[model samples]
Target: MAGQAEIPADVVALCDYERHAAERMPAPLRAYVDGAGADGLTAQANLAAWQAIRLQGRVLADLRGADTGLRLLGLDLPHPLILAPVAFHGLAHAEAEHATALGAAATGSLMVVSTQSGLPLEDIAARAQGPLWFQLYMQPERGDTLSLVRRAEAAGCRALVVSVDAPVNGLRNMEQRAGFRLPEGIRAVNLDGMRPPQIRSEPGRAATFLGLMDAAPRWEDIAWLKSQTRLPLLLKGIMSAHDAERAVAVGVDGVIVSNHGGRALDTLPATAEALPVVARQVAGRIPVLCDGGIRRGTDALKALALGASAVLVGRPQIHALAVGGAAGVAHMLTILRAELEVAMALTGRRDLAGIDETVLWGS
Candidate 1:
């Protein structure tokens, strides 16, 4: 609930918020927010991949009435950036998802609320002034997953972003090193009373192989869930052309090329690398969105040029929330949108449609 005054004058960009947030938050909390999987190769790669892409600048092109707006799944977004779903916002700010919702609404940015949100989906939906899309982690029981989808539909969620990667937690070594644990009273409120079916492994069998992954949702589960919900369904964690084609064949609404922010698995290809390939495979049959290592406006522009219809910003939302609560996050999105405009103006692109592989050098 912090006001605009809480936003520091020097915090002009998302990276600035990242630095301020580290100083403001507890070490363990920061570790949990920043940590990636083992060796951090993929996380580093995500950032580097975006940086490696070069934009082509144009001169003397008409730039009148430039726009950043776009429509996805029938929802009109003021800009192409979305607040990617991240779990347990309470770890960053006391207002938690409520603050994030207010911030997103303030700037007309769409937010995908996590299945593991610290606040109830209904409560967050009530506070959100803009659009809310629920990110679903399909449960072991079809009934349980369907119930969650029904709640989201009843709460006015515009879409369902089903995360399909990580049936198990990633090997987050940094979190382990910091001994990170969710503070008392902070939990996934939406998941309360829903118990996962037990999967016991016999002796001499690896539990992860024999039991834990048994709960992972398969392609059939996604198709079945799509049948149960009327909402536009998007599959997250898509990193390959084959999966993208499969998703299209399965009749899903959209695909988000992601590596779980490099938190799900190490050494995986960054979203920047995966996006173009997936976008090509889908062939515009569905919208392609991506998240991972998107810290600047130029990064978003790069993603779009590479075939992403829109890009999602994840960790930066937490960094902004931790630093200045709701206002901080609002300011963060404002900065990104402004930067996108600047990039577009310089690249001689009047609207998002003007952006394509042509904007990238050596395309």
Candidate 2:
């Protein structure tokens, strides 16, 4: 790739694969994938947050074969791993979302296909053998958003994931410096034919939130969206317990504690810091999942011990998809799963049920 040395067969870590993929990608797209908020503090925190708690591994336990299987929103996954929906996979490779979907299928991992997918939802769904969840970014018009949902349902998506934190794009220093623009060939193809609802904004001397997110959905909107579809509904980007409670009250089936990979708001607490509080707030009323800074199995295990029912891997899968297409996605997950199983065995856990807060050294 780009005259770079091919990825070594023994290089199992995601970071290594990412390095290999980075060699192939153009600078602007690399910045888009790796760059974070204003100063990248939040992005750094998403990775560093896991350092606070250490694992208390047990020495004297029967560590035979261990399983990492998990169920989220009624979908049984081979592991507690889900590939997070990231936009514009075409940036990494030519095959784009189709390759990523195939990778998820190969690993028996649940995949959340983004609203800004490079491929049509139907094509992605057809390629994924494992469960597919459509991550929704509401169109300015309600009917258009519902139309997208109907399309997902028709394409056999198992659940609907509504991203709630972003009304407007985050201020990304990297993208700004890189002069990032959607290159001529890549686009969010699935958004074709959607129209925006007219937004009325008054002339103002001071800033206001009203016009900030023209298509931003509110509580009533979420409730109405829930009523429009029978598919299991999940809310992503929830950081506060108050929001978690409101979502549960609004009848959402699950919650994903995320900080938009620290790409949205620059200074938000890492997803690692938010999951516990939200999990406590939900109080097992609904399944709670998490994403961001999940590079290793220990990181994932910590999320489970903190309160997540499962975890989603974003950049790692992208790296895999970039290098090996669907097969690359499979290899990346296989490595991640192996690391997780090793962590489980050393910690005296034989299965996911055996994992809890006790495994955390701080506990």
Q: Cα deviation of 128 in candidate 2 (Å)?
A: 2.3
Q: Write the per-residue lDDT of candidate 2 for residues 193-237, one digit (tens) a residue.
A: 877545566676222255546557899999999999999999999
List model 1 lDDT by residue over 1-363, tens digit each. 434337888999899999999998888888899999998999999999999999999999998788999988998888999999999998888899999999999999999999999999999999789999999998887888988999999999999999999888899999999999889999888988887757786878755776678778899998898888789999999999999999999999999999999998999998898998998899999999999999889999999999999999999999999888889889999999999999999999999998999999986
| Alpha-carbon shift of residue 164 in model 2 (angstroms) | 0.3
Worst 10 residues of 1 by lDDT: 1-10
Q: What lDDT would candidate 1 get against the real structure? A: 0.92
Error of 2 at 246 (Å): 0.3
Tell me the TM-score of model 2.
0.94
Model 1, stretches more than 4 Å misplaced?
A: 1-5, 201-206
Where does the lowest 10-residue lDDT sum fall in candidate 2? 1-10
Candidate 2 regions exceeding 4 Å error are 1-7, 197-214
Q: What is the lDDT of candidate 2?
A: 0.86
